[model samples]
Target: MTEKEKMLSGEYYDPGDAELVALRLKARLLTETLNQTSVSDADKRVNIVKSLFGSTGRSIHIESSFNCDYGVNIHVGENFYANFGCVILDVAEVRIGDNCLIAPQVGIYTATHPLDPIKRNSGVEYGKPVTIGHNCWIGGHATINPGVTLGNNVVVASGAVVTKSFGDNVVIGGNPARVIKEIACSDC
Candidate 1:
């Protein structure tokens, strides 16, 4: 398989591959333009985000200073909103479901390196996908790590570093986040 294909499949692949480099460059350019756009130009920002992301819902909004690697690997459902300084390293698929809100400085990462120093130093890296379910709220400065799958109506507390998956209707917090409490999902 090609490097891009391997990367998407969560296999170790050379990130310096030409195709991957070009894709990253493209994403960089697009995000730069997106960040520089005047807040008054909402239409233009929306258009740029449409062009940059692989797929997006009808009502998606992202604040300034947003960055991502391989924008095509990121997908968002309806009424998605990301606050300022949101960075997503989408080496693999990063999927966020409907009515998701991401606060400022929130980071969703899908990139990982081998534990073996030799292998890690070889410039071969892999990634695991991240899936956030519907109506999730990621608090400011929270980090969702690789391979984490959060179920619906989950609320992440500020500055939490989530390393593992959690099911629906829970509040998670702290480094290597743990479930703080189960939420009251009234609509569920």
Candidate 2:
């Protein structure tokens, strides 16, 4: 399989492969253009964002200083808004569902290295996909680790480190995020 295929399949792959390097460079350039666009130039920003992500639905708004590895591996659904300094290390797929809000400085990482020092030093890495269900809110400075999936209408408190998946309609918080409470939404 190709390096990209391996990467997408969550297998160990060389990140420094020529094709991967080129893709990252292209994404960096696109993100730079996106970050530089004036807030008043909404149309231009929207166009750039459309080109950056693998797929995006309508009414998507991302604040300045957004960065990602391999923008093509990221997908955002309709009415998605990411606040300033949102960074996604999407070595694999990072999918955000409709009507989601990502607060400032939120880090969603799908990339992970081997635990073994010898293997880690060889520069081979793997990634696990991350998914955020619809209408979820990820608070500022929250870190969503590899392979974690947030269920619909979940609220992750500020500065939380989410290490595992959680079901719908819950409020999670703290260093290693735990269910703080259950949200009783009338619509749910």
Candidate 3:
């Protein structure tokens, strides 16, 4: 299987493969466009973002200093907002659904290295996709790890490290992010 196919299958693959190189080049160029000072038009900014990333809906806002490893692997739905210092290491696919608000310094990472020293030294690694459902609010400094799928209408408190999947209509917090409580629709 190809390296990308292996990655999508949740298998370990070499990170230095040609596919990764292409993705890196694209990301670098896209980042440069995003960082340009002369681009004052909002349409141009949106178009640049659309060209860089795999897909993005209308009315999306990404603050400056945003960084990603593979922009094409990241997809954002409608009315999404990512604050400053947001970093997505999307070695694998990362999908964020509609009306999601990602706070500053939030990180969504899909890359993971082997725990064994020997394997780690070989530069072989694996990645898993991350999915955030609709209307979710991810707070500042939060870290969403690989293969985690958060359900719709979930609220992740600040500084949380989400390592697992969460069901819909819940409030989660703390390291490794446990569910604190269920949120009622009336609270909205």
| TM-scores, all models, native as reference | 0.99, 0.99, 0.94
* lDDT tens digits by residue: candidate 1, 43-126: 899999999999999998999999999899999999999999999999999999999999999999999999999999999999
Tens digit of per-residue lDDT, candidate 3, span 128-151: 899999999999999999889999
Models ranked on lDDT = 2, 1, 3
In model 1, how large is the Cα lDDT of residue 30?
Answer: 98
**Ten contiguous residues minimizing lDDT sum, candidate 1:** 179-188
Q: Please list the C-alpha lDDT of all candidates, in the order they appear.
A: 0.96, 0.97, 0.89
Clashing pairs in 1: none
Q: Which stretches of candidate 1 lie over 4 Å from their true place?
A: none
Predicted candidate 2 versus true structure: per-residue lDDT over 26-94, tens digit per residue? 999999999999999999999999999999998999999999998999999999999999999999999
RMSD of 2: 0.5
- Model 2 segments more than 4 A misplaced: none
Two-way lDDT contest, 1 vs 2, winner:
2
